[model samples]
Target chain A: MNALGNAFSLLAGGERETWWTIATSLRFSLWSTVFAVIPGVPLGAALFLGRFKGKRVAVAMVNAIMAVPTVVVGLFVYSFISRSGPLGSLNMLYAPAGVIAGQALLAFPLVTAMSYTGLQKLDPRYNETLLTLGARPWRRMIAIIREGRFVIVQAVLAGFGRVTGEVGVSMMLGGNIRWYTRTMTTTIALDAGKGEFERALSLGIVLLGVALSINFLSHLAVRDAR
Target chain B: MHADAVRNDAVRNDAVRNDAVRNAPAFSVSRLTFRYERKVAVSCDSLEIHRGETVAFTGSNGSGKTTMLKLLNGLLGPYDGRIDFLGLPLARNPLLRDRSVFVHQHPVLFSGTVKDNFEYALRLKRVRGAEAAKRIAMTVERFSIGPLLEREAGRLSGGETQRVAVARAVAAGADVILLDEPTSSMDSASGSAIRAFLLELRRSGTTLVFSTHDASLVLDLAGRSVRFESGRVVDEPSTGGTL
Candidate 1:
């Protein structure tokens, strides 16, 4: 009970920092979702709607990537951006950009795979109906995408939630530098590891709040989809 | 039969026969074949649908009625032979896309409000603002879908959804409306409404080709019937079921 009281007091006292942390996490998530969705949606749409040889292989690979370990993604990206690595000259390491990159990679396959599932579940007759209406290919694509908007929205929310609360990528790639590269997850990790239990618990509570909000939104989107 | 009824029937039959010959066929399929993998869905068939005429294609399940409709709109390319729509060969010229439209058996409704679903086809064609609104209103009134315009499409009943689907297709300015079981899932009231709409469409010179399993419905609407069996058209009217 004392611990919970201390945690709440710490959160109340550190409201500014808490809000900053939340704002930064949101910024990162928004950019990551934008980066992920741009290519992810079209790729998923093509893989599910287009008919060509080896399409199955592409879909299989994306589905496999959905389960990719976040730590593994961090490690893999770390190798390429580290001081001695190929992209080392960019010096993106230990920055929010690097964290975004890692999160984008982690989120992309998830968004794509879920979007693909949504598109595949659509009735093929929709495509045919559009084509018959003299809709151009681009037009047909838009119509189908618009029809599947609810599913796409849910996929994006899920992807955002996955990245916002993820620790492995931010911890490894951002180096957890306070007020520089530190996100909520990384802050919580650093505070907990250093025995700043109140701060850590505060961050943890905030992260939980974020997760719950995202889950609520996703649930609403799915209900709207039906 | 009553004298007035006999006269009306004779005049209707004559008008149908004359129209069949006078109006150039909106769709002409010659020696067409379509296959999925190694199995044939439709084989070496010839058909022509005249402009402003309502033609019905009837057959048992898997008789290729749906496949034939798909061919008219370039939804499926033919494996052999040719399909000409509005004097353009669908294979050689892609412009048939500009003038033809198709409606599916199971209507596709988007996840937005009813107005959004109705406007989707027009928006694709780049119609917007007041012009788009006018056409939408016209269609909504025509289909009596005014109450449904603000409702989410996903929440509509099957019959209401089908009405919106048909309205959207028609509003897209389809020179040819191909309905695949448009009324298959509707209640009697909705079915009657749709039938009335199709009749009005016919009078307005829109060419309609539809497939149905309902014999009586076909008899009431179609001027001619084309029957298929085992992937081929059985030519004799004796074998071909009457509309």
Candidate 2:
């Protein structure tokens, strides 16, 4: 109980390091979500709109990837960016870029799977109407994306939540370098490991708040869509 | 005298070709079979629709009338046989979409104002500027839909949505319109409005194909009737239609 009180005071007292850690976590998560969405949404749209053999298998693969452990994703990216690996010369490891890249990779399958599943719920008549009106392939996709924007927004929020709360990617790729690469989750892990419970509990509280806020926004998106 | 005889023969041949073109069927189907997840939905052996003809497909629920309409519009495919539009094979005729449009039963009006829906349809056909404005004006006047123009399409009532959908199609310059149960579940007022609009379309010499359970619609509008039973076309007969 005393540790919880101290955690709240630390948050209320506006400690500089704690706030910076929160900001770094948010910034990295936002950038990762943007990177993931750039390619992920279109891939999801293709998976949903395309008609071909092996499409079912492709969808199944994306779903399976979404369930993969964050540590596994971190390891995969680390292998690529580590020295002597394929992309080692870029020097992304132990840097903010590496953390963002790792988080984006971790969120990519989630965004793709969620977006595809969301688009599946769109009205069949919308596509038929677009087809009958002679919309070309590109125009049809844009229209479909616009029509399902609400569901897509939910998928994006889900991706943001995923990267924001994950510890493994940040710990492995960002290297938990103090004053530079340290994020809320990595800081919490480090502080908790050193028997310092107050800051860790505070960051946990913040993470919970972020999760609830994302869920609320998702609900609002659905309501507006209706 | 010899030259005049040759000229007259040439004119006669040209006239014959023109008549044949004018009389060509809008759609011709042969041995069409469409299946849904292993169960046959439509298996039509032969069907034809003439230019400027209003044809009604009458059938019980799940009897494949809607599927036939979709096939005719080229919305579904991989069927076993062939469909020809205006004497050319359907597969080779990409311009068929420019000349034909399909309307669903509930009529999906895109998420915007009714005027926006009209603009979208016209834009699909590459109609713009003065010509698009002219078409919108003409359609609004003809349908008496001026009041509904600025209203959000999603908020429109059932009858209004159907009216806007058909009017929007007309504005897009569709020569042939296929509709699926346009008035199946409408109230009397809405149903009457749709029937009246359909009558107007027929009188304008547009080729119309529709599926309906309404007997009076068939009696009043159809130039011919096709009946469907268990995914097969049972009969197609001219009923002295179009009163």
Candidate 3:
């Protein structure tokens, strides 16, 4: 009970460390979401529109990737970005860039798979109408993306939430350096291990709040879709 | 003597235009066959739709009326035979899409205002500026759809959606329209409105290939009727002109 009160007080008081941690988490999640969405949405649209050979296999591969653990994604990214690795000269290890890359990787398949599944539910007439109206391939893709905006919005929110709540990539790549790369999830992990429940609980409350907000927005998107 | 020369010149031009229309069919399909997975959806030995002809496709459900309409408009392909548009092969004909359009049984509008839908179709044809606006205005007034111009397309009723769909296609300069049951699932008022619209299109010399179960529609507007049964052309009489 006392720990919970202190946690809220810490948040209410706007402690510098807590606020900074929240900002770092949000910044990393936002950039990663942007990076993931840039290529993911189009790829998903292609998977939905194209009728080439092996399309089923490609879709299954994306779905499989979406289920992969975040820790595994972090480890995979670490291999290329670590010192003495192929991309070692770039020196991305234990850096914000490294964490952002890892998180983006984690969210890429999520965004793609979600967007594809969402678009699959669209009425078939939309595509036929676009084709009959003489919309070229690229233009058709843009139109479809616009038509499926509700589903795409949900996919984006899911990506942001996935990256923001994950501690594996941030801890592994960002090194959880205080005043540098410390994020809410990583900070909570460290403080909890040291029996410092106040900060951990505070960050947990914030994470819960974020999760609730995302869920609320996702619900609204679905209602709008119907 | 001057008036007599002008009359002769006009007669010569009409003969030339008629010859051109006869030589170039809107769609010439030969031995076309389309399959969905393992099931054949459409099989026709030979078919031709001429310019300014109103042809009706009469078939029961799953009888390939919709599929044939789609095939005519180049919406479905990789079939077993050849299809030509305007005497040119489908792939080589640059103007095929520009001159042809298809409307589904339950038409779907884009995710914006009816005005936006018009603009999108016109933009696809590269029609912009005052020309596009002029076309929209003319179509809106013609179809009595001015009240629907700013309404969200998804919020429209079935009849309104169909009107907007056909209007959008015509405004974009389609001379050949392949419609899949344009009047199905409509109230009497909506059906009458759509039938009136189709009559107007016929009067304007637009080529229309439509699927229908309504025999009265065929009797009223079709110059020629083709029947389909189990994906095969059971009967197709010789082509005739509505003119």
Candidate 4:
């Protein structure tokens, strides 16, 4: 208990390096969410609207991707970004950019799956009125998106939460480089490994605070969207 | 003028307009059929609607009255049949949709003001600038819904929403307005307002094809009444029909 109290002092001490790690983690998570949502929204909306063959198969594939372990995702991305791999020429290995890319990949499934489920629940009356009013094809699609926007925002929040909590992908692809790629999750793991239980516990508390903040903000947004 | 004199004046006016459309049916259908998977939704052997006609399709729920209105407005294509609209083959003509609008039974308002909803329809029909503004004002006045013009349209009462739906249809300059239970959601006052506006539309030569279970609406607005039962038109020869 004394050690935990000391850790709290260390955290509350406002050290510049610790704050930098916090900032870096948040920046990477934000970028990851931004990238995932771009392609994810259109892809998810199309998955709902497009009536081609293999639709069930495509949806199943998305659900399967959502179940994949984060460690496996890390390993798969590491292979491509490693020095001897095909994409190594870009020299992104052991960099924050690689972490962002890996985290974006992790968040993509959450964004897409939630969006698809959200739009699937839309009322059929929206489409019916638009079509009967002689709305052009593009206008009808835009109307559909607008109608499903609340669910889509929730999808985005879920992606943000997932990326912010992820440890495996950020640690593996980012290589935990000190003062550069070291993030909140990676520092927590490092502190625990070195038997620095106090720092680990304090950082875990910080992570918990951040996660709660995100969920609280999302709840407010959900109410507003409603 | 006396009420009977006004009725005779309308009849005479209809005759004069009929002369211009003497050769062509407003809509002609033969052996029309529609199916939803294994269930037949609509089936009719033959039907024709003359120009400037006001018709009502009356039946119980799921009796294919709404299905028939949808087929007429080209919102749903017939599984097997030929439909001629305004002297053109409906299947090949892309302009048929431009000439008609269907107000849904439960109207879904766009996410904006009442003015915006009416403007969207006018814009789609390529009416713009001063012309579009004029049309919007005309519709608002015609429906006596000037008070609801600035409010969020989706938050309106059921009757107000239907009024806006019909107004938007008119703003598009559609020659034919197909309404699927436009007044089923309204109170008596709102219903009478809708009927009066519909009569105003008829005077301007806009044909109205509506579906309703309201016997009074059919008696008041429709010159022809088509009755449906079990997904089939049971009215023929001696029953309700257009002459």
Candidate 5:
């Protein structure tokens, strides 16, 4: 009850800060999705279509990645971007870019695994038809992707949902600095820890809204893909 | 890739031939064999099909007719023997598949509208604008699928999807259409419609090689029928041994 009351209070007095946090959250999630899905889709399709050796092992690796903890991802990326690490020369530590990199790694496995199952289940008859019709290699690939778009789209939206609400990656990699990399989830965590219930509850509401929206869209896409 | 064989790149006979017997056979094979996961699916020796011939491969389940059809269309390959398309070996005729389309037992209508499925091949072959439109229109009307053009292909009834699949193959203008049980699961109305469509295709000079367990369809449609059992075409020919 107190959290609900605090949320309304924050809504009245903290509109600008709330909007900024939401914007940062959206930006972080969107960029992470882009980075993850660009490579995830082709890799997923190739894993499904290619019949060479050790494909099962590759697929198993992706499945294993999906089970990894988000905090572990945060730590791995944090270590890489730290001043003493190999990539430290870039000075990305505690920056929004570091947050994006960590979150992208967190999302990659989900997208690949989902898309692989999607393309794997696709009827092989379509490929044969395309070949017999003399579709050029590029055209065939594009057509297959388009036909398989629903699975990829669902994977992307699911990844976006996960990344949007994840506090560990942003808290560790972005340092959750106010007026800079402070995203909805990270701010909510920090505010709650400091007993600032209104700001925390308000941020929680915004993050929940984003997560619900992504879930709704994913539901529609899965149904439509059928 | 044969080391000790003469390459018959000339895909025509040297002598003049009568209209009844074409100079080039549609498919000529010697020792054609295929295996799937340690089980021999097809093992045929010395088989030839002529142009415009309607050949039915009748067999029980798991008898390898479908596998043989796939091999003929270049979908499965690297078999035990040579397959010549119109007197030229597969190695010399890379465009062989462009001339032969295979329709599966349960044709998969991909995710799109029926019109999209019908136009997929034409667009692939780069048939553009008015020509593509005209062909699509002609095919839709000819196949009696005009009402279904706007329906989602993936949402269609099984029989409706099969009709569209057959029409798509026809619209693509493939020389040889290999169908595996095209009418097996269809309702009587749909079955009769497919039967009529196949007859029309035959009249249009499109060669058809289909597998079926339906003896009546073979009796009504095929000029030649070959029985298959245990992965080999039995010597009993329904018509003359050679057409």
Candidate 6:
């Protein structure tokens, strides 16, 4: 009971760094989604719609990446961007950009795989109809993408949810610096580790709320697409 | 109006002359073959379609009628033979893409209103504003699609959707319209209405090539019947007369 009270009191104290952590996490997640979505949707559409020799291999790689662990992604990116690594000259370590890179990598495959599945499941006759209409290749692609916009939206939102709730990548890459790189996930881990349970619990609640809202919106988008 | 009438008569005379010339041997298909890997879809030795004609390609499932239609529209390239469209070898012509259009067995509707679907093809042809509006209205009214213009294509019934599909094809001004079992999903009323619509299209100087299993419907519409058995045209009539 005393531990619970202490945690509650800590939350009530309203640490300025906690708010900054939440803001940074959100900003990082937003950028990750933006970067990932721009290429992901087109990549997915091409994989599903295009006829090319290496298309099967590309699809297989994306499907494999869908299960990649966030911490592994962070570690892999960290090796290149760290002070003594190949890209060390860029000095990207312990920064939001590093976190964004990790999160973007993590989100990209999810968006792409889901979008590919969505487009693949569409009626084959749709493509035939477009061809019969004398629509050029690019115009046909644009029309199909427009028709499947709702499914694409859901895939992007799902990617956003995955990135925003992840802790391992942010902790490994962002270094959990106060007001600079600290994010909701990292702050929650840090506060919990330090026995500041109330602040951790508050941030946890906010994270769950974000996840629920994303899932709800995704559900709505899927329904709308139908 | 008189000039337009004279132009129309000239087109009709050309169609009649082409039809007569077709009787001497109109459609020339030589060593036509297609295959997807090891699976051979179509292997026609020879075939011909007359001008101003409605030809029906009938076959059981997987007999390659649909594939033949695709080949006619240049959607699929021939593995062997040459297909000649309007005295031009199909393989060597850029005008084939502009001249031919295909309609699938199932209508594919965009996520917009029916009017938008009509306008999409017109807009592609660079028709806009009053010119576009005038043609669209004429097409919609001709096909009795005015009530359906404001409705989303997704909400249309099967018959209504097919009607709109045919309307869109006509509005696109395709010289050779290929329909694959277009009336297969419609009720009798809708099917008859569609048949009537095709007759009107023929009168308006459009050449139609379609496939159907419904013998009665085929008898009513097709001037030439091409029967298929296992990926080849088994029997064909050379009457070249309107049904």
Q: Give the best candidate by DockQ.
A: 3
TM-score of chain B of 3: 0.87
DockQ computed for model 3 against the true two-chain complex using alpha carbons = 0.69
The DockQ figures for the candidates are 0.45, 0.62, 0.69, 0.39, 0.58, 0.46
Q: Which runs in model 6 stand beyond 4 Å of their true positions?
A: A1-19, A79-92, B1-28, B87-93, B239-242
What's the lDDT for all of these models? 0.79, 0.89, 0.89, 0.81, 0.81, 0.81
Instruction: Report the lDDT tens digits of candidate 3 across residue range A1-226.
Output: 9999999999999999999999999999999999999999999998888879999999999999999998899999999999888988888889888999999999999999999999999887888889888898899899999999999999999999999999999999999999889999999999999999999999999999999999999999999998
Cα lDDT tens digits, model 1, B1-243, are 122432458676455434433544787778887887778888756777778878888899889888888877777853788776655456534345555677778777766888887677788767888999999988887767788899998888888887788788777766678888878967898888788878877778888889899877788788777887877864324223232
**Distance from true position, residue A59, model 5, in Å?**
2.3
Q: Compared with the true structure, what per-residue lDDT tens digits does model 3 show for residues B92-182?
A: 3456678899999999998889999999999999999899999999999888889999999999999999999999999999989988898
Number of residue pairs clashing in candidate 3, backbone atoms closer than 3 angstroms, sequence gap of 3 or more or interchain: 0
* Backbone clashes under 3 angstroms, per model: 1, 0, 0, 0, 0, 2
In model 1, the runs with Cα more than 4 Å from the true position are A1-5, A12-23, A79-90, A194-198, B1-24, B77-81, B111-119, B126-164, B235-243
- The digit string of per-residue lDDT tens for model 6 on A41-121 reads 888877777878888889999989989898999999999999899988887789988889889989999999988888876
lDDT of 2 by residue, A103-203 (tens): 99989999999889999998988888988888877778888888899989998999999999999999999999988899999999999999999999999
| Cα lDDT of model 1 by residue, A177-223, tens digit | 87777788888877788988876787788888888998898889878
- Candidate 6 residue pairs in clash (backbone atoms < 3 Å): A7-A198, B27-B48
Candidate 2 residue A27 Cα shift, in angstroms, is 0.6
Candidate 2 chain A minimal-lDDT segment of 10 residues = A135-144
> Compared with the true structure, what per-residue lDDT tens digits does model 5 show for residues B84-176?
776656653644755778888888876778887767778877777789889999998777788899999878877887888888877877778
**Backbone steric clashes in candidate 1, count:** 1
Lowest lDDT sum, 10 consecutive residues, model 6 chain B, at B19-28
Question: Of models 2 and 4, which has the larger DockQ?
Answer: 2
For the second chain of model 2, what is the TM-score against the true structure's chain B?
A: 0.89
Total colliding residue pairs, candidate 2: 0
Pairs of residues clashing in candidate 5: none
